[model samples]
Target: MPSTTGSATAPLRVDARPELTGDRRIAVLLSHGFTGSPASMRPWGEHLAELGYGVRAPLLPGHGTTWQDLNRHTWAQWTATIREVFEELSATHDAVVVGGLSMGGAQVLRLAADVGDRVAGVMVVNPAVSTLRRDVRLLPVLKHVVPSFPAIGNDIKKAGMDESGYQRTPLKAVHSMMRAWPQLIADLPQVTAPLVYFRSATDNVVDDSSEPIILGRVSSTDVTRVPLPESYHVATLDNDAPTIFARSAEFVARVTG
Candidate 1:
């Protein structure tokens, strides 16, 4: 869970124009989770690129640095970063599918709602917007008293593999995200793009609280839920990652075709 500094944590963009390539030229925007950097998603991005898809994974604001700096960023900044990447990709790419992990999932849902059919499709891994944790009830006051809590990073079942995220959780940033859930949920029906949700059967960081809400409210009649039994919350970096990578390529092909 400890932070690590390297090019691995930097933002990644793999450009492959449709004019040069063929059907696989569809672009995909991959967003990382909160307290997590691009490192967590780099492998998946690379995999998609290997399949001939253009890929981008942006480091959210205040991430790839320190947890203390993460507290300085709000949900707006984080969401804006993803939105910007979508805009950038949309400008050149004929079609762009948006996807994310954890908080990144929620952020892409926001984009799906905002841009509607402009998004070719949607994919999410362990996307979380709600929690069953009881301690969050005290965030209103506790955020002011305590700066952060223990790390929620490195919740992977994969041994020796780190998510390369913060070693601590920033309470203020946590509160900001939690506060925006109501609006995000309210806007769920606005999301009409085809959605493929990749959820881990057992996740330590994000519970099943968000699944029902997203699946039930989304207006997209075309929805598929794939369960990953062999991984934890950071399933993108876990054993079932290949399942995700392969299925995700098929998903992009299905939606973009």
Candidate 2:
């Protein structure tokens, strides 16, 4: 992974609120990954907002503050936050697209499954649904003994880019995410919204097995997978970011048109 100059010990950046344009008919609710703040998704949201689409990238409950904050939050609270934003957007927008990165991706999938056809489209980048690593399986027990681990934030392949996520990984939160995975997978068949999935060719954090699990299980007939050749897990901030922003905007237009 490419390295940046910012200090991981520095304070997390503030969350980015929805930048609403005059055109409220089209709205997008984007969520960042588990430990990540809205900074990772703000650029993407701003691009869409510039196109006259209303975009909201809410900070997850425990993110963008401290690692201890994340440990205090659960998977249910994370899902609840996104769901509320999605519902609010749905009320005003004629079309709404729910998207996220990594864990955020799984959260949006759950939203699509819960709301079904109401969602105009779904977008995900380097979605983490299932992990092939046996180590994650130990989360249930390990979380009790271990309080934290090395951070998985800032997995970008681009230099000088700061994701502003937590400096450490909270084991309790990781355990909560792992516990929710099975239910998310089980609900995949109910996700009938059109989907555009972006998978990185080389991701150091999320394993390759995750892509197949999501693609194979989702019930959406209208699905497209684009390969991010030069990016890693945080493709939103990597060299291929422009590709994701442009394609996702096009996808929204196509689905909502």
Q: Count the backbone clashes (under 3 Å) in each candidate.
A: 0, 0
lDDT of 1: 0.90
Query: For candidate 1, which ten residues in a row score worst on lDDT?
Result: 1-10
lDDT of 2 at 135: 87
Which pairs clash in model 2? none
- In candidate 2, how many Å is residue 93 off? 1.2
Residue 25 of model 2: what lDDT? 69
Estimate the overall C-alpha local distance difference test score of candidate 2.
0.84
Considering only N, C-alpha and C atoms within 3 Å, which residue pairs clash in candidate 1?
none
**Best candidate per TM-score, number?**
1
After TM-score superposition, the amount by which residue 86's alpha carbon in candidate 1 deviates from its true location, in angstroms, is 0.5
Q: Give the TM-score of candidate 1.
A: 0.95
Q: What are the runs in model 1 whose C-alpha is more than 4 Å off?
A: 1-6, 17-25
Model 2, 1-257: lDDT tens digits are 11122443222222222333333368788888979877788778767766667777777888878898889899999999899888877787788888999999999999999999999999999989888888887888888899899999899989999888888999999889988999999989999999999999899988988888899999999999999999988999999999999999899878877
Q: Cα miss at 56, model 2 (Å)? A: 0.5
Q: After superposition, how far is residue 55 of candidate 2 from its true place, in Å?
A: 0.3
